[model samples]
Structures are given as structure tokens and as C-alpha cells.
Target: MSSLPITREQILRVAELSRIALTEEEIEQYARELTHFVDMLSVLDTIDKDGVPPTVTLTFDPIAQRDDKLEPSLPRDEALAMGPVTSDGGFAVPKILGGEG
Candidate 1:
């Protein structure tokens, strides 16, 4: 069993560091939930996996990848014609990163 225990003070400290405002009820609830999570991890620590190979994925089959091939693309004018909005022979999209649209 793990000697370290999750406490309400720890939860409150974490909440404060994360700039999250929690009610007294919420603080108590999170303290219990976090403690349970740590207890579950302690249970995993009791399991013997010394000889087990670390698994990156559940499947044993080899991954299949499609062969990369050079393909002809549509002409610039034809491709631009398909766009909902086009400017200067290219598709024009709304600016998303706090820049001029």
C-alpha cells in the first residue's frame, strides 16, 4: 500500500495553481476522486509484470501502409474555379489566428 495520501489541502492547492474556483463541496468531491485514482494506481503496483513485454498496441498484425505514388493534379484555374471564394488565382479562406480577414 502507498504511504502517500491525497488530501483536501493538496486538491485546494492544485485548484488554486490552475486558477480554478471550486466550492467547498467540489473540493471535498475532488479530494475523494483523486484519492481513489491514486488507490487504483497502488493496486496496479501490486501486479507482477516482470516478464511481460511492453505493449504499444493491442494488435499483433503488422501495419499496412499504402505505397506513395506521384499523381497528376488538377490545373490551377480548374482548381480555383471549384472554390467557394477565390482571389488572385487561389482559394481565399477567413483568417482564423487573430489576423485581418
Candidate 2:
């Protein structure tokens, strides 16, 4: 797949979606940067990878299992005492986007 060329409108839309208000100069600079990045990615997309298998590591026998050891955790009451607001043995945080309280 080919990378797309970014436009000013797209940048504005992205800024709106991200809830960031960008100045005119910043918008222009970001649009140019994004366009250049897409162009570079287009060049990368032309490389051949037909026979290559995707793997996280290049070395053989890279996987190893470690010995598991039991570790003592803080007492339940002590842990709960550190929380700002906890209930039912769990930390309770405020709603992230103001929906569920």
C-alpha cells in the first residue's frame, strides 16, 4: 500500500480530533512535516519482504524460562489505606472523560 499525501484540511481535522488548537504557523509546519514523513514511508514500502518471516528476535534459541518465586505482597488493609478512594479491595478513580462516576 502507498502512503498518502497529507493536506492542510487533514491536519486541521486531526488537531480537532485530538482536541488541540494549533496556531496557523504550527499547522503549516506540522502539515509539511507529516507530508514529508508519508513520502519517506512510501519509499520504505517499496522494499521486498516476500520470504522474510516476522520475528521479534534475530538470534536462535532466544526464548528462556525463568524460575518463578513467590513474593509477599503488602497486607490488604495497608494497600487500601494508600489509595485515595478504594472500595471492595480495589482502587476507585474518577471517570476519565466524565461519563461513569
Candidate 3:
């Protein structure tokens, strides 16, 4: 509640920094909405929770996870066969860092 109200200039500046184009009406709308949101959050400051414990999660059960296992891979020759170019038993690609393709 002690925080200063949001301003149109602040909204416009934020939109400019984000590279967003906003109309005059849109800027006013966002300024009002952001001010309302902050006011609502400020209400939390008045709550009394002296004996309450912070909640981490709703459930304590261990999460089920699939076991990691190695599987057979495709043969190199067969894999290279699908490529447009092949060289030395592997797929051939153009050199990116520079020299020769």
C-alpha cells in the first residue's frame, strides 16, 4: 500500500525497452491493470500467519521415474546410406569453420 502508484510514463518506458509498440489507450490500460495487481499483492502484508508452516508440496510420495537403459543403435553404413553425401564410412558435410567442403 505504501508503494507509489504506477504511471503512464513507466508503462511507456517498459514497452519501449521491450521493443513493443503500444497505443495511447493500451498504455493507460496496462498502467491501471499493473497498479491493481500490485495493490492486490500488498494485501498479503496484513495476513497473520504466526504459527503456520510453509508448504513445500501437496504430496510427499516419491515421483515415479523410468529406468535409463542403453539400446541398440543403427549400423553406421545403414545410417550413412540415408545421407546425401558419404565419405570414409560416415556422412559428409560441408566444412563450416572454413577450409574445404
Candidate 4:
């Protein structure tokens, strides 16, 4: 809402939260993109609104959800057959990052 728009500091903070490291050029690019987004929101705010009700979605109702019915599943041996590796009724995977296998 502030006309000051997004800053490089804000971009850096966002990148940190997302666990991403950005170069100086990337930080400047993201700041510019965020500023443009704010400008678009500002333009949207200037449109006339009379009798329009705020709706979360254009659809009439929430998208229909599938019924939660459990069906027959694969037997343990059958399921394990498709896995790359398996242990006692569980999947055994290769070493994950930063840990020994």
C-alpha cells in the first residue's frame, strides 16, 4: 500500500525465507518485479465497484470433493515389489542429503 514500493532489503528477506540465495542483480530484478506488481494492484483499486459482492471464486460452489472411501490396496509384498529398496514392511532409501546411508 505504501508508495515507497518494494526494497532490496525486502527482496533479500523474502529470499531468506524461501531458502534461496540471490545475487545483487537478482535482488534488483526481484525488487523491480515486486514494484510492478504493486503498481498493478494500485490500478485495480481505482476501478468502480457498486453492487459487486466479494467472492472467493467465480464458481457457484466449492469444487466437488471426492468421497473418502477406502478401497482394497496392494498387499505388502506387492507394494514393496515396486520400490527400489525395502526393509521390514517399509521403504529403504539411499542416503539422504547431509546424512549417512
Against the hidden reference, what TM-scores do the models get? 0.44, 0.48, 0.44, 0.53
Off by over 4 Å in 3: 1-3, 12-20, 49-60, 70-101
lDDT of 4 at 3: 57
What is candidate 1's lDDT per residue for 11-63, written digit by digit as tens? 98999899899999999999888887887778778889899998877777888
Name the better of 1 and 3 by lDDT.
3
lDDT of residue 3 for candidate 3: 63
CA lDDT of each prediction against the hidden true structure = 0.85, 0.85, 0.86, 0.86
Best by TM-score: 4
Give the runs in model 1 whose Cα sits over 4 Å from its true position. Answer: 7-25, 70-101
Model 4 TM-score, all chains together? 0.53
What candidate 2 gets wrong by more than 4 Å, as runs, is 1-4, 8-24, 58-61, 72-94
lDDT score, candidate 2: 0.85
Clashing residue pairs in candidate 4 are none
Better of 3 and 4 by TM-score: 4
**In model 3, which residue pairs have backbone atoms overlapping below 3 Å?**
none
Count of steric clashes across candidates, in order: 0, 0, 0, 0
